[model samples]
Target chain A: MGFGGRCFRVQWGPSALRRFRRSGCRTVRLSTVRDSTPGQRRVPRPVDDGDVPSVVALSEGRRHNGRVANQSGGVTHMTLTAVGVDRPGIVAALAAVLEDLGCNLEDSTMSILRGHFAVLLIVAVPDTIGAETVEAALAPAAHRLDLTVAVRPLGELPSLTSNDQTGRSRTVGGAGADLGEGEVYVFSVHGADRPGIVERATRSLLEAGGNILDLSTRLVGPPDAPVYVLHLTVGFPPGSDAAGAADTVRATLGEVGVQVHAEPVEIDVL
Target chain B: MPVRPVLTLPAPVLTCRARPVGSIDDEARALAVDLIDTMKVSPGCVGLAAPQIGVGLRAFVVDVTGHRKAQSCHGTFVLFDPVVDSASDLQPAREGCMSVPDLTGDVRRASQVVVSGIDPQGVRRTLHVDAFEARAVLHEIDHLDGLVFLDRVAGPHAVFPRKVYR
Candidate 1:
């Protein structure tokens, strides 16, 4: 069916751009601030005295591990990792600290795993700022929230050029570029957990000239015989045989004892 | 009638329930013409509601004669005070709206529908539509009741950012 024509493509104007900005698309991902009533006072909760020791121990452990490295080159990229007991305001506090340090958050994923809130973020800072400076700046908030924070300097970003025999070019800094001029599809694979499933499936797709845009995997079921589920959003270059590439990916992944399915992510315009 | 600009979200007229066109007067017929004109000028626009063009009246135009998904082909037609006589076979499909640009959402709508309404020629007509034509009719009907696809999405995650089309 010609579903493409049914999807509405917005014609942008000045007013539309203003509405897009006011939509709060940026802050909606990680954190949302609630407006308080005019005269309402929010009382701060008292920090547990016993939590201080563990916070100090965790911070010391991170420092001793030597994970914080100094890069002498003009490195502007850094990865920040933080973990603490799940609570409100952790993201807000960390964001405040980063803002004070003049760091721009590029990409981040925050989630609660086994009752602990973890944040892993890629940030861009001035060339003069080192990983140690970020770690030092986060020390106060980390201690206040009983979080273990670490920062590691990243290597040079990959230039926007085709790196392999395939004509696909890698997006700079891996910030997940828009799938320009491509056919987007969702690839789903699920089966009993085993080693090399991701490698084998992705390798076959890559060979078929499919570029993985976003990927997420989960392991569930009993630990003895865990089931793995992998979902990937991939893009095939325009004019490429998307159906043939999907069949190849499915067949390749099927050989690894998994059920694979691929479908076009269709959008309808009104 | 000149083709009017299609209004987007947060436009109060789009959300307010459109008043019924009790009589097919010159103004109501003019609205029908404007709806069709606007839909024709907007490439790929299969349907348009009166409120989308700031009319705030119960009327819409739909055409799916050549669409690939269209099974029950209906040439361009305008309806005033459309009432869905019957609808069945609910199915979920992703749809975008000119009024809610930059996003698409999954909406469960009936695959088969029978509707009766007053045509611009001052005649009563009923249509039995299925597949894409039915979907288009239901979408335009929503505007008459002050509802959009955003209100019908399955959940928050059901909405997705749409790529801009040149």
Candidate 2:
């Protein structure tokens, strides 16, 4: 099927934006809120606290790490990923170093992946700072905490969470106006565990003209008959066929013996 | 009545239990009016609690009239120190908040409820609410208790980020 639509295309193709790991990658919700940014509303979640798809435990004292963005006018985004053996004071030490470096923790996710403490941070670094300075600044903390770290700068950080007058939604992957601003929906799929499910399902959704916001897959049940569950948040630009996209996804995943449920994530204002 | 600014998350006032509005006095009446005014200004907002407008009092206004999801419409009414006399028929519903503006969560609330509270006219009224009306009542009451929809989510993925926060 031709992947042609009115949606804007990313420079690095669809796969370049988001990675869907096959075989064994369970999405975990790492809710480590260190400091609450005043007047800013976070993407509120029902925390199973230290448990999610794969249900990994959170490190200690990681308060306000993920949804802690108070910086208003920074256009640069530097994504930092750190992985190392799990231990106490890891998150706290990282947060302190980031704070000390004058780099604002725009967004962060920390979780124990495969028994390792993994942290992915979207930092708002001032123009005066560079990648080397960040990596060097974090070296001390990384060493003390026995962590491996890397940082890369992405161009033009879009305003997330807060709705600008434009209401233009741009994810970290730089899929700006290319992905039309529209209502967000959550698509949950589950079935017997099998290889190529992630690849086929994600590729089919893209072909069906859907913009993926977030996706996480989990494998559960006994090894004899494993059950794979995938939670995907997707959006379609205005005037796109949402129902049709859902049907296409349903059919595509069904071929691989998966059941699908698509629901619009409408937030009723109370 | 003025359309007061609604506070978002991390605001200490939105998390603390509100003080009781013992009587429907002028101050209580004013709080009720502001709640109504604020709710009216925001399109798609069916309910507003006193704490949302920075008033730490147990008061709120709701008007689900003509709302598509509303089955039992309660034109428009304000309550002071509202109390849930009975709530039954638990159901899951997606809810967003003016205080917690950026995300919505699938929260389980009663589909039917009997709530008693004093109105703006200094008269006590017991409301029989169901469907969306009941959800709105419970949501407002949650605000008075310093709780938002985030506190009642069913699971981690139950919450979804809003593309736009009004």
Q: In candidate 2 chain B, where is summed lDDT lowest over 10 consecutive residues?
A: B157-166
lDDT of 2 by residue, B16-102 (tens): 789998967888877777888877767667888888788999998999998788898879999888999999999987776766545
Per residue, candidate 1 scores C-alpha lDDT tens digits across A119-218 of: 7887766677889988999999899989999999888743222212221211111111232446778888999999988998788778878888767789
List runs of model 2 lying over 4 Å from the truth: A1-29, A32-77, A126-128, A166-181, B9-12, B88-90, B154-159, B164-166
**What TM-score would every model get versus the actual structure?**
0.63, 0.75
For each candidate in turn, the interface RMSD (Å) is 13.1, 10.5
Candidate 2 residue lDDT tens string, A200-265: 778877886778878778889999999999998887767678778888888988887889899976
CAPRI quality band, candidate 2: acceptable
What TM-score between 0 and 1 does chain B of candidate 2 receive?
0.96
Quick one: RMSD of model 2?
10.8
lDDT per residue for candidate 1 within B1-166, as digits (tens), equals 5677777655667767889998898988888888888788775678989988888889999998788788997799999999999999998878877776545678899999999999998899999999899999999999888778876776444665444212
Error of 1 at A149 (Å): 8.9
Model 1 residue A84 CA deviation in Å:
5.6
